[model samples]
Target: MAEWEDGFWSSKDGLRLHYRDYPAKAGSTRPPIICLPGLTRNARDFAPLADRLAGDWRLIVVELRGRGDSERAKDPLSYVPVTYLEDVTALIAEAGLDRFVLFGTSLGGILSMLISATMPGRVAGLLLNDIGPAIDPAGLVRIRGYVGRGGSYPTWLHAARSLAEVHAVAYPDYTLDDWLGMAKRLYRLTPAGRIVADYDSAIAEPFKVPGNESAGDLWPLAEALKPIPALLVRGGLSDIVSAGTADRMQAELPLLERVDLPRIGHAPTLFEPECEAAIDRLLARVGRAG
Candidate 1:
């Protein structure tokens, strides 16, 4: 396994957040990748992918506020993307990083666009996994149903089984070991030996409010990445990003490269061969290769 160290930085709002920093091979000069996970996901979501790339380039996987080891916001309303962008900027400053590539999944992908828009030249490259300017309403509805629904299980096996029941559609070929790995990524064991979702249930408050999901189109923010090296990875079975939207995105940003994982849904785990190949191409565009 690739080695990594725990890192912490404070958000502008004084929230202490956590991240995992994996160093590159000695003397390697490739630009680092700052991974941002999906809503309700944390740094652990990138473990498999990070380990795969750590030998060639540095990796910094962050746990957004209210998720994983990061401090939970006292106010559930603080879970919005704007605050997340602020926290990311703070991370850049605290980490003393000049420029880095971005690897974001779902909500993290949305944040990548916004951050790129705000600071165009600072992002050397962008990889948006299973998200785009347009999000399918059906997927939003499905995700909303479970994002904040927390549960406790008697053992790790039970937690893994529960997770598989909820997400089996996305990974039909997943074996027991696969489900077990996913359980570790999404849940944590408490001192009392109860296994529960790692994120704060309050993180779902924004989805409950009216008009929040369709506030506006993200195309404008995504447009900011036009001048930078970028790639979009979509799950062939994903409902979050429809074929129509992906087609339109390519039309708008002709320079944007793309990949589709046929067996995955909602999101493509970056560990997939196709996703990894696309990432290599994206990094090569920025003069970094694995």
Candidate 2:
């Protein structure tokens, strides 16, 4: 098992955020990997993947504000992507990272594009997990239905079962143990012994605003990764990233590497063999290969 260090950095607005930093194997010089999790997700979501990749490259899995052990935003509106971009930038500076490969899932993927656009060439490579330039409305609607609905469970098993009911569609193959593992990542056991969602319900406020779902043209942001080595991983059963949108992204970024997981929906766990291979290929393309 790889050893990891706990990290904390102050956001621009003074919130103390957290991240887990896993070092590369002894004497290795591979470029570091900074992972960003999906909306409503925290750094724990990347633990399994980070453990697998840490031997090849340093991995920093960040807990976006209001998630995990991080401080909640003073203003709920601060949960927006633009604000997240600022926080990510601060993290990069705090970590003294001049360059790194980005592994982003969903909302994290969107942030990767925005960051690349603003700081072109800083991202050595990108791995976008189940997100595209164009988001489907149906997916947003489905997400809105459950994103902010926080609940408390009497036991971890109950919480796991409840979560499985909501996300089983995305991981139809997951077993009871898999659901339990996922529950641990997505929920926290409170001091009162109740298991609750890890992220702030307030984080969902922006999505509720009128026209916020389709507010911006992300294609421009997506294009920012065009010159950098990139990989796009999509779930074939995904509602968030349709096959058509993924095709269009490939057409737009001619260099983009792609992997489509037929059994998953919304996103594929980055620990999968295919995803790991894709990451290796992207790293090679960007000259970060071991």
Candidate 3:
């Protein structure tokens, strides 16, 4: 297994944030990849991807405030995308990243688009996993139904079974072991010895406010990818990113490559062989662009 150093940085508001820093191979000149996870996910979500690609290019898997080892926000409303952008900006400066690639999943993908737009010429390559400017309403409804509903399980198997029950539609092919792995990634053992979701449940407060459920008008932000090397990974069964949205994105960004994982749902693990191959191709393009 590839090793990584635990990294910590302070957000603008003095909240402590965490990330995993994986070193690049000796003599490697490829731009480092900054990974951002989904709304409810943490840095552990990217462990598999980092294990595979870290040696070729450095990978910084970030744990946004209120998730994983990061400090929870004192104000629940601070859990907005704008706030996350600020946190990522701090990470960029703290890491002294001049130029880098972004590998964003879901909410992370939205952040990648925002970063590209706000910091032009800094993002060399973009990889958006299972997200687009316009999200499907069905997906939004499904997500809203469970965002802040916290649960506790007495054992890891119990937690895994619970997740399988709730998310079976999104991952129909997942075996018990797969669900167990996902449970570990998404939950943590508490001091009392019960398993619970790793993120701050209050992070869902923003969703309570009407019209804040989704980021409004991301198409302009998506436009930022037009001049850069980009890749979009969409799950064919995804309720979040529809086929139409992915097609529109491709039409808008002629340089963007779109990969559809037929067996997947709202998100591709990026551990999928097809996703890995597509990412390799995108990095090759980035290398040639240099």
The candidate that achieves the highest TM-score relative to the unseen native structure: 3
Judge candidate 3 against the unseen true structure and give its global Cα lDDT, from 0 to 1.
0.92
Per-residue lDDT of candidate 3, residues 150-210 (tens digit):
9899999999999988888988899999999999999999999999999999988998998
Where does model 2 exceed 4 Å of error?
Answer: 288-290
| Location of the lowest summed lDDT over 10 successive residues in candidate 2 | 281-290
Clashing pairs in 2: none
Rank by TM-score, descending? Answer: 3, 1, 2
lDDT of 1 by residue, 1-290 (tens): 78999999998878999999999989987778999999989888999988888978899999999999999998889999989999998999877888889999999999888888988788888899999998999898889888898889989999999988988888888899989988898899999999999999999998878878753688777668777888999988898999898898888886699788887897777888878888878888888422
lDDT per residue as tens, model 2, 51-140: 777877899999999999899999998889989999999999888888888899999999888888988878888889999888888888
lDDT of model 3, residue 56: 83
TM-score winner between 1 and 3, please give it. Answer: 3
Q: Is candidate 2 or candidate 3 better by lDDT?
A: 3
Candidate 1 positional error at 184, Å: 1.2
Candidates sorted on lDDT, descending = 3, 1, 2
Name the TM-score of candidate 2.
Answer: 0.95
Screening candidate 3 with a backbone cut-off below 3 angstroms (N, C-alpha, C), the clashing residue pairs are: none
Clashing residue pairs in all predictions, respectively, total 0, 0, 0
